[model samples]
Target chain A: MTAPAAAPPFHRPGDLGEALRLLAAHPEAVPVAGGTDLMVAVNYRLTRPAAMLDLTRIGELRAWSDAGDAIRIGSGVPYTRIVAELATVLPGLAAAARTVGSPQIRNRGTLGGNLATASPAGDGHPPLLATGADIEIASTRGTRTVPVAAFFTGPKRSVLQPGELITSVIVPKAAGPQQFLKVGTRNAMVIAVCSLAVALDLETRRLGTGIGSAGPTPLTAPEADLIELPWTRPGLFNDALAEEFGRRVAAAARPIDDVRGTAAYRRHALAVCAARALRRVWTAAHGTESTR
Target chain B: MKVEMRIDGEAAVADVDRPGESLLSTLRDRLGLYGTKNACEQGECGSCTVLLDGDPVCSCLVATAQCEGREVKTVVGAVPRPVRDAFIACGAVQCGFCTPGLLVSVADLLAREGDPRDPVIREALAGNLCRCTGYEKIIDAVHAAAEAMADEAHRAPARSRAAGSTEETP
Candidate 1:
């Protein structure tokens, strides 16, 4: 592995001001929280920032709060924290967080890093997208909250500008009965070939779905509108509707074959996750979401 | 950067150049605690497992800077006598490469859970992949160790009572 060039003078910024100042001075510098994803990039020579701003020490981005209707998750909060702290309020996100890498990865990998990397296959994306979450981005100038749906521009690309940092992701507590499922080469510590996150609101009888790793960005399946799912069938999902869901989910993905799995496999996996996700929603509608 | 970490209850200081530098590097190269083997510099292998503040994490993925001012227990200092004896009795040590890490992980689990089931033990050792022995003996050793520890805990009060009576007579 190509070692990161003696990380241009380590600077431990004390506060947001110091952090912005450092970022402004070093335009090519990278901001890292958890350092799980960035370290891999640095090692692989995929990313070479002139300097790195260690955000783990920053107090502002490490605090989480459940304020009224929405729950705000600090970008610095680790996956382990998601499982341990927010699982009850945010089960979908917690379940997705648990599936990220192993216990060690879950301990160090943060939702912020996952979002910043913006991999379509990122475990956190679909869940956040389904929640209609908003990301708070801060820089020296000011802070602005962008809807999670508009956060991604393309594959591994985000709307975030230089010198900007994601402070927190705000998700609504009353989203619905949410579920996240992913198909990987292995059960753990493997990247997702295809993944699905779906949420159903019994109060409104509405369903929202998000598909990942099958497209440039996570696709919000218009299952409720474009596809005629037998929502009234109750308990049993019609095979046609299920197949239609799978087909729509596959159509939404733009996967390219790689060593991890082929494009065909990814497409099939996307269909499977989409079908399983529909069944999961049906089951939750009837009883409870089973533990994996 | 100068990082201060507690290795086996002793304070250690080392200067690392980058944020991605692994704890395994510092332990093996700088602190000379070679017991924590480095494998799959990525976290896919458990050869670098170590207890960071009592939780088992892959040392290769942990930034040495993160461990600054934190307690780090490597395999060399983490394994207890009972755990070692159980491994010997169960013939769990095979190939000798993966033993230290596996032992450290199991020890941490047992210390936390008292007596872990086979599945719990398997999950604890999931990251630490063993090519030899097929993991049967290692799992058996962990089960044996937990039972042994539980028996000792049960008898401790009785032994103390006997000692108290003897002292009173004297």
Candidate 2:
């Protein structure tokens, strides 16, 4: 007599087509990949869906393949595999994956789940932003690719539409060294206070910086200085420039005070992380001071 | 919903009656396999840890229906004798609440990684938390188990094969 009469149907689709059809039919369904986030909500009674679209059985969603100039990582690929398999190419993302949670969580938690949850503190977001990754989203109707920077609309919110599922993410292979750094109360299994990811492309002389936790959404610094940084010139990648990059990256965030950290703390931490990340990537991409 | 799966090297079908019940609850309440603990319904704690098709995952976070036709190995029949002996020898069981999960996790580590260093051991056990916080002893047990298993492998290839076959049983 207390709870609603609707017992949600559990649809475990074995393939992408079946999953998309289920989503199309039950657009109100909550799509679950790794069940890392959805199961928590189910356990806590946070959200009661009309139906549950389980995407784990879809084999295509659990694989990665090579796109033209990039690697298309399936949305359902677990973090453990990324850390093990993609480290050489997606070094920044792999670093973030290593810092995600414990070994168990990494075995189950996924990048697509993080993006679908769209938490401001999702570790995968920063690296995707830094690598200029594109999110490939799909539905029964069609599919579309959105840049990771345009994916999030707000905290725990995304541009994902009704009946849509994240299929994969396309990240350009690391043309140069990449680095990701995070600040937490303690290292293991802690939510990010703030995190930063930096990628410098030697071929294109492009520098990308992403900020996490200290923002309404995972964001890019987008400063003209960062865009105009002389990445090819090793001497220019000094502490002063890196510090300014850190400051601008911090400024780009629209952080609010929360249980994990205060807004001021997040801003300060982001700046420090960003500066250190820049120096790390610069050194890895170019050379040590002695070598240069 | 009735799910048919291989649990602990046995074929069985479990009846899941709840709307959103986890594999942990189904195992404890329906199937009566209570070796896995039920703390922290969230995936943060590894108390309800089980091997879902040989990969350690929080059973509390797994839908019972989704485990259909897949393998699930829990602490009851999965933990090797040497691992348990090492745990007892090292005094890793304090209060005994987190032991089963820790045992399963440690067994997994020993099986997958024959020799793990201190940091790797710590990182592997990071998800399983002991409220009693006897982590030093647990680390000692993991090292001891690894060495014992290696010794067993060295001593009798046949016994080691049997253990491996039992774990890898389809």
Candidate 3:
């Protein structure tokens, strides 16, 4: 309560329609979801908007629906719900969610807040990014789906306009062999030094790994050498590819030396996370135990 | 913002300034429920643990607005008699800073988990940071509490049946 002298005026909309109406009228109003990340910013006076558009009462943005081919998660859905219900859909994400903060943080923090905050170390980012998620942004004009790849502009920045609201995130049904891993300071309640999420396609023999905290935005390795290929003996691609993947992950990350960790440590952790993710994916695909 | 809560079996409503303020602040400042201590404003420390609708949650992390119409029980609510007796017998109350939160958190665990193993107890209370007693006494207190509760549950039916159909043995 001792945050700042004057808090901004808050506007609580009862439904999505009223929320959209407020956003349409006041372009300067900031959308407050969860307030986990925003509270820190507000306390520090990083960015102060005149008004807050509250989304807690909007039922439309809090419901998740699976429509045969894809699952549309309302942006307001907390990570706890995702971990409990959607584990099989994306196991790696569930694993990562278990690592997010303590239970209370997971209970209150939403995937929408993670994306909107756009922190490089956000646990929700790499999993959603690797799953080929699409964000639906709504305004009075209309609603449009934007690919997650193009959603982030930089550290703590996104492609959303002032009057736009991220309504939901849609993940396609075809995602396969998903795995997420992160190394932090502790078992729980610690932000990631580096995190990675990998999804493998069994039929196409293609793999994608999204790495976070080593970059400004979530970094994706779209065309990694598939470990699912049938091979009998050791080859040059066997040992070297993992090292290459590590280097690629390091190259993709634009990490900085912060209080939590150093840039060098982040690079090292990113490589480890990326290589371990690949090994886990390979094991899941082949039904074999990973040596790593 | 108005926060209506069933606190310790009593209906209470409080008008708060910021809806986004944490429940830890609300309990301490507005409702004057100081049983939940504020150690870490973040969720790392379980000092602010309170039962939200019968589930143990860090009151410091949950927004006050979310507590509206929910049942919130603070440490002022009696620690289950078994747990309190165990804590006393095991000498778990040194400074007793973490006692309230630990008691509430452990009470919820015992109620839900039905006397978990020692390892499970450690894992369950991992979020709660206890600086005193070196944790051995606390663990002892928890185990004793669980055993006592189990004993009481076993004896309850016999006591009830004996009380109901007892013929007067003049």
Candidate 4:
């Protein structure tokens, strides 16, 4: 076991402004929330910052508001709250949250933390991508909102600048039925090897697919035109259409071979997950189970 | 840094010198609360489970600085007598490293939901990893504890009623 390094100065800002000011003053300081992922890096001496800014104390960053246009989730909101409170409003996100590590991990792990880590395997990403969420960022200068698609540049990297902090995520309410599915080695406490989320927009007659753990970053499949169906009608999905959508989703993936799984296996898993999610969403929309 | 918090219902202050020091380290090394075992520090195992502000969290993942002004209850403080006795009665304490965390987790579950079914019990203790006893005995212990606690609740009112009648007669 590695002995922990010497203690560095720690700061806990009471407000978002103070946090930003602290960040500006110490660009070397790292921001920590829940500390589930960051602490792991710290424990292994992977990266040592001169100081740490604790964001859990900021009260405004711990709330969620429904603004009619979008549901704004504060970055500090833990996964447990999302699973418990927002299941009906954001079922896809709730489903992903339910698959996170464990009860203890869920209680401390936040969506903001997951975004900050930006691991391709992050379960929070696919749901956010599927919902077309926006990332709200803040610094001492000001705040800006970026689309989730534009946020990630690579694995464990994002467009977030120094001294900037993620404040909240703006997720649009589902236009129709949506579903998230993940494949892992174990039933619980495991990271997703590959995951997929599918959403159907009844008004637009379009389908959205988000793939995870099978690419350098969370990916969105190109919009697939839904088969012509009554705008008001549900249950338009069929075996052929679902299979085509799944194949497109799998084609968008650029997975690499790793210890957990092979690239071929991930592509295969992504196809299955995409198909399963589409079927589930179809069943949900129609209020009837799919026979095939 | 000087970190202060309420641990096991007692005020505790420890000088945490390491930047990456965890609440589990502070509890075990500084405060001598060895009941909260530290098996896997990566949060993979729940050996270091503790209640922070009435919620179960992996203490190993929680920094000592984060615990300032918070209330922490280890297994010694969180586990009730009935639950502890039930674990022993059901032979659930093999090796005993995972017992502290399992006890704390079960206590929290029982407090929130009385007499959870087997699936509920399994899900509640999913974070805790026990290499021995295969978890059947632990589930039995949780059931036994719930029954024992229910029995006590049933008898308390009756005993109080009997005492009231005797006092009235006298």
Candidate 5:
């Protein structure tokens, strides 16, 4: 019988540069932030890496900056901090963060960790996709950015290269009303059965849609994006149009039968969440216009 | 691997046997600070909750070495009095297995919010699961603790009560 791989070497780099150097030197080192996902993997013996790069001590990755039109949230910034500090600017993301695990999980789980985990069911993905966010990835070689929509390659997978560490998530400021809702069996601390995020850019008349846990990876709905909204119309909302948009968003899912939910239930839940999210965002955006 | 951190304002060092030991294991095994419970070694259970630099987190998910030079407040040395008293008064203790972690989490919550409402209290305790109580009494304990603390604050805002002095029923 084969023996288990030896426990991975551990490094606690204090800065991003040092972390990048360690990652570059040891490409197989799994970067751990908050340990919300990675620690679970380690505990379950699901993943055994050659080394573990601890990013908790990196002060640079915990500071968010106002980057002109967008916010550059440091990869190590906890969900609790994001909810407390950035809720106004990144409402959808903050809303999603609020629904994550619980007080303790939110206190520790970082957005970068969520993005790195790349779970189809990760609560952070839908909001990032809805806001047209970009992920800033770094290595000793240099740094590069990937659009959030294009970052996920498959289930629990991303475009992150070996030796690269996620530095920050560049989330565009919410331009209009945004709504995020997740369906779950319990009220809190439960993973989403399925989730949806909708953001409407009133000025551009563009609708952004994100669906979670219904696909191979966190998915965005292109057809739903192109849906026609009659901003100039008297009532400003078409129930049938919104319902059709929900259907289109549901069509985008490649759901599978998982323990949390069946594909058919996921599809149904996605459609409901999609339609409700659309109506909520549209109404809210229009409310802003009328109040103005 | 030797991991060093301050627990409840005192420095502690754990000479860990496993190369990748969790802070939970280090606390429960090496240092014998079993106040942080150890059910569901994964991040799911809040039984191993502790304050990492004033923020409550599951110790099971924290790698021991990563806590170097940081501050941790487990239920052992940092138990809050009002929360503990209120837990007993409200009969919140059921199996008693979830008490220590629940106390730590509630202390953190009450520190953040003095008078948390039902929904807020419910939201705060959601991570610390109790199969026996079904959460109603736990919610009551949070309210009672908040009220008691608030009244104490009015009476003596400057009073500095020592933490962890109240005997916890094991």
Candidate 6:
């Protein structure tokens, strides 16, 4: 038997400036916050970066602050904190965060890590997409904000360039009731086979829907604006409108068959999830029993 | 590379060469704290659960370097006596592979909660996977431990009052 290979070296930066400088200097270094996803990949030998930049020690990246119209959540903030602290301000995000793996996984999984991973099945994406969130990225060169819609270029890929690090995510406060629903193999510790998030912006009379694990990347319904529902009158939401909305959401999906589920099954699940999420949000907004 | 941290209330330093080495590996291989079992190196199994700064996390996913200056509590030194006794009394140990993680997870839950219901206990231990005993005995162990701990807490104040009265009479 031969000896095991040594693990790669890691640089733990104390501050954001140091982290950015290190990233700028060493483009080959991969920045890891919670390490829930990245560590798994490293262990499986899927990725072999020359060095790892542990970002958990940076206090600036672990904070959440209230911006003028949006709430800024640091990338290093774990899902546990998001569920506990931001439930009232970002209910949809909190709901999505609660559905992530187990309590232990949530304790260490970070929002930034999830966004960085850009998995099609990522639980964080659908909610962020529905909320029209922005990803704040920083580099020694400068800082830039990209809309979440344009962030993911493909599966397990993001628009983040070399030497750039995701600093925080900016999500606008909910304009109305929001709900997230997911279909998985089990209740807990299961990746989403298909997920849907519905957000009703009453003030703007707009309904936003995001579908996950059903396509190449987390996607918002292109016909979101076309699916009209009576926001003020709950009784006006009929099964016809709900079914149409679900069909439109499912039509936007470009899913493929995989071991977890079939493409047809994923499309069916997305339709059901979308309809159910809309019904739940409608009921909550109207203080009535869910029609479904 | 050298990583230093407090494990089970004792300062420990391990010469971990690789950044990818988990805290669980260091605890078992270097410090000889085999109480924290290693079943799934991934975070799925939860067999290598440990308390990092009082938060229950998967030791297998946590890097040893991340524990620098942080406090870690493994099952060997950190599990309370009542929890251990309750496990044996309730016959929660089967293969014992998942017992350590379950004990640590349950201990954390019991410490923070007053008297959680059955559903809460089940949810708390959902991460831990036990191949033997089918989890009924383990749930019983947690319930039994909570009852015993609550009983002890109730008796402590009464015992203190009794002692105070005796001293006054003398």
Index of the highest-lDDT prediction: 6
Q: After superposition, how far is residue A234 of candidate 5 from its true place, in Å?
A: 5.3
DockQ-best of 1 and 6: 6
lDDT of 3 by residue, A92-132 (tens): 66777777776556666788888888887899888777777
Return the TM-score for each candidate structure: 0.88, 0.93, 0.85, 0.93, 0.93, 0.94
In angstroms, the error of model 6 at B138 is 1.4
Please say which candidate is ahead in DockQ: 4 or 5: 4
Q: On residues A235-274, what C-alpha lDDT tens digit does candidate 6 reach at each position?
A: 7887777788889999999899998999999989888878
- Identify the runs in model 6 with alpha carbons over 4 angstroms from their true place: A1-8, A288-290, B158-170
Clashing pairs in 5: none
Tens digits of per-residue lDDT, candidate 5, A6-42, equal 5447878888898888888777777888888888877
**Candidate 3 error regions (>4 Å):** A1-11, A25-33, A40-53, A173-175, A223-237, A288-290, B118-123, B133-136, B158-170
**Candidates 5 and 6 compared by lDDT, better number:** 6
**Deviating ranges (above 4 Å) for candidate 5:** A1-8, A288-292, B17-19, B157-170
Give candidate 1 regions above 4 Å deviation: A1-8, A14-17, A44-50, A223-237, A287-292, B157-170
CAPRI level of candidate 2:
medium
How well is each residue in B33-102 modelled by candidate 1, as lDDT tens digits?
A: 8889977777777788888888778787666776767899888788877888999899898787888888
Error of 3 at A154 (Å): 1.7
lDDT of 2 by residue, B1-170 (tens): 67898999999898766546788988898889989999998888799889989999999888887888899999986799999999999999889988999999998998889999999999999899897855999999999999998888798988778989999997
**Clashes in model 6: which pairs?**
none
Residue pairs with backbone atoms closer than 3 Å in model 2 (clashes):
none
User: Candidate 2, residues A79-103: lDDT per residue as tens digits?
Assistant: 9999999998899999999998787
- Candidate 4 chain A weakest lDDT stretch, 10 residues: A223-232
**Model 4 ranges off by over 4 Å:** A1-8, A223-236, B158-170
Tell me how far candidate 2 lies from the true structure as C-alpha RMSD in angstroms: 4.1
The best-first sequence of candidates by TM-score reads 6, 2, 4, 5, 1, 3
Instruction: Give the lowest summed-lDDT range of ten residues in model 5 chain B.
Output: B161-170
Chain A only TM-scores, each candidate in turn: 0.88, 0.93, 0.88, 0.92, 0.93, 0.94
DockQ, candidate 6, comes to 0.55
Residue A128, model 1: lDDT of: 83
The per-candidate count of clashes, in order, stands at 2, 0, 2, 1, 0, 0
